[model samples]
Target: MLARLLATAAVGGVVGFIVFHPREAEATGPTATVDADEAQRWLLGGNAWFVKGGRHVGDTSVERRTAVAPSQAPSCTILTCADSRVPPEHLFHAGLGDMFTVRVAGNVAEPVTTGSIEYAVEHLGTQLVVVMGHERCGAVKAALSDASLGPNLDALLALIRPGIGEIEDLDEAVRANVHAQVAGLRRSAILHHAEAEGTLTLLAAYYDLDTGVVTFLDSPPTSAVAEAAASPRTPAEGHAPTH
Candidate 1:
């Protein structure tokens, strides 16, 4: 009976050791990557916050310090004009790491701009791309006035010229510019592939500085009108038709 008791104790001790001293300790893995759909929802939520006039007064330095030590979440890519009036983060009421933004005069999409956007969508996995154009864009005005631009300014104007030709009226021109940029992005090889594969969405939007309301241009591309000021065809090209 003593021998049987010793054997049972040895077996129990062995089982206890096996349970306590696992061959491989399980450590916490990396944090999960934010999915594209979740990112989009976050972006819309930020916009809703803006619509409600929510204020974020937290210490940015503290937030930045914390995020610097680890990873952060970026939900959307906003391509907007360089107009001082349009502060992307503030307008969208987005906090740090909530948006990946690209700004250029007239919000023109050239190779460099497109490359940045491609990086955001392809590498950063941003699901929603907002092409935001604001009221009275200087670039559009310059294009309309045929103002002589400096070297860099010339290149900028060139990018916006096509869109200008599509609109006869200045107000319409502004809206058309947004539409043109959106269509340009849609036709972009990288963006088009992602859109076709249902990986990303491109939205064209105009921000009314007066009303503080952002109107999304949701009309089908076929129904939208191109600006006459930006088009190649002359006035003889027939009444400026809608897209």
Candidate 2:
């Protein structure tokens, strides 16, 4: 897919030539060695731009496509919910090949997902992992309500149930579930070693559907305190769910 896009860029004329020659290199900058703090700050800036209706630079340009054709070294890996409204690339105003994203219904990290994250960190040199949960997520709502579901869905929700106890509000449950997923991710030895060695940082975040805002929950509370700590908060804390 990346190769095809690059081919089109190669033949696309003056604009293509400019995009191919110098612009691509300058825009994509080698992400292989980006530090966790720099990567997270970049994502936060992009999210702020998205909330302000700013256009993403060089995202779908032919030059960008061509530059990343040979290889991809995304700076961060995002584990977010499968909500259509919260596409990670779009929410963060990131370009193609800039973010390695893994999407599941509730943003839960099972063995498969954890393995993928490990690969991104160990192989691709991705520095940051953002586990993003969103407001009014259908999967979360179903799990919180204990809605009768098919066997497959029931099993998936069971993974989420351990995180949410008696949290009645949908938003609060969503937050707790994020922490729970973080806890699950911490169990990965690969991730543990990376964090210990200062090569990786795992973060929790929340997305608001209506406001197009993403809030990074810095130093998220541990799972032991996740349920107990969730409480109503003002907009600054990213607790007010517009949806």
Give the number of the best model, judged by lDDT.
2
lDDT of each: 0.58, 0.68
What total of clashing residue pairs does each candidate reach? 17, 0
> Candidate 2's residue-wise lDDT over 206-240, tens digit each?
99998876777776544422322222111122110
The TM-scores of all predictions, comma-separated, are: 0.69, 0.77
What's the C-alpha lDDT at position 9 in model 1?
18
Model 1's lDDT to the true fold? 0.58
Cα RMSD (Å) per model?
A: 21.2, 11.1
Pairs that collide in candidate 2 are none
Question: Candidate 1, TM-score vs. the true structure?
Answer: 0.69
Off by over 4 Å in 2: 1-31, 220-243
